[model samples]
Target: MDQKQVRQRIEEIIDNNAIGILSTVENNKPYARYMTFLNKDKTMYTPTSRETYKVEEIDKNSNVHVLLGYQGEGFGDEYVEVTGTASIRDDKELIEDLWTDELDNWFDGKDDPKLIFLEIKPEYVRLMNGRGEPPHSLDL
Candidate 1:
């Protein structure tokens, strides 16, 4: 697929799948965890607490990886591998915008002092195992 087409596909996958694996580097090793994400204009955001280990790791290294979009029905299931830079976002407006009731399990509310987000801006993204096609890169 061309860049535009690949981008559209990438966006579709991200928009469709809110659950993704977010990986960060910790002590020169990879640490990954499932996260609920929200995106706007191809950038990803995941809510977390300011006290989380991932936040500390991100402070040391901005590079991150995200994998989303596979449904586990086996082969031909398309997925995305996202490589990006992560930065902490504590903006109250952003927190309010991405907030969901489910987050109550973790935070008291959107106004919780510990509430924060990891804003991941894609640097490279690849569409993997797409239907009837080889992998394609959404060149930034």
Candidate 2:
């Protein structure tokens, strides 16, 4: 698929899914965790605590992988994988803009200094359709 198509597909997947499995490297080992994410203007946002292991891991190694899709019992086969470098942002305005009641489930309504936002600028993405064989990839 073309760049535009890839972008659109990624947007669609992210829009449909709120949770993603984010993979990061820690202590020279791989770590994966489920996280709620939001996408805006092709950028992925994940709110987390600064004290979280995943946050520390990302600080040590910016390279990260994100998988967003629906995997139900005998359901659709849609999936999207995004690989990129992530950075921690402490901008209060950005954090407030992305904040919602749903986030209270994680941070318990605490937006302290420990609260941080991870901005993932995707460098590559692979999108798969339902029961498809060949997947479409885009390198940005």
Candidate 3:
């Protein structure tokens, strides 16, 4: 598929599955964490704390990877792997707007000063289906 189609598919997949694995590099080693994400205007959002290791790793290296999919038994299943650079935003307005009671699970009901949002703009993505064959990739 073309870049536009790939982007559209990725957006659809992300919209369908709000949870993903966000991977970052720390000390040249891969660090992966599960995150609940929001997508808007081509940007992906996830709440995180500034004091967290993921934040520190992103500060040193903005590169990040995201894996999104559902584990189920059947055909026509979908999955995506997105690679991008992340930016940390501590804007209270944005954070407040994105924050929901559901987010309490991540922050324990305390909106700590160190808590912020991670904005990811994907540079490339690879999409796969249940067939488990070579994935079609798009360069953004």
- Minimal lDDT window, size 10, model 1: 130-139
* Residue pairs of candidate 2 with colliding backbone atoms: none
Task: Identify the leading candidate in terms of TM-score.
Answer: 1
Residues 19-55 of candidate 1: C-alpha lDDT, one tens digit per residue: 9999999899999999999998778999999999999
lDDT of 2: 0.85
Answer with 1 or 2, whichever has the higher lDDT: 1
How many angstroms is residue 14 displaced in model 1 relative to the true structure, after the best TM-score fit? 0.3
- Whichever of 1 and 3 has more lDDT, that candidate is 1
Record all residue pairs in model 3 with backbone atoms less than 3 Å apart, i.e. clashing: none
Candidate 3 backbone overlaps, count:
0
Steric clashes per prediction: 0, 0, 0
TM-score against truth, every candidate: 0.94, 0.87, 0.84
RMSD of each: 1.1, 2.1, 2.4
**How far in Å is the alpha carbon of 52 misplaced in model 2?**
0.9
Model 2, C-alpha of 29: deviation from truth (Å)? 1.5
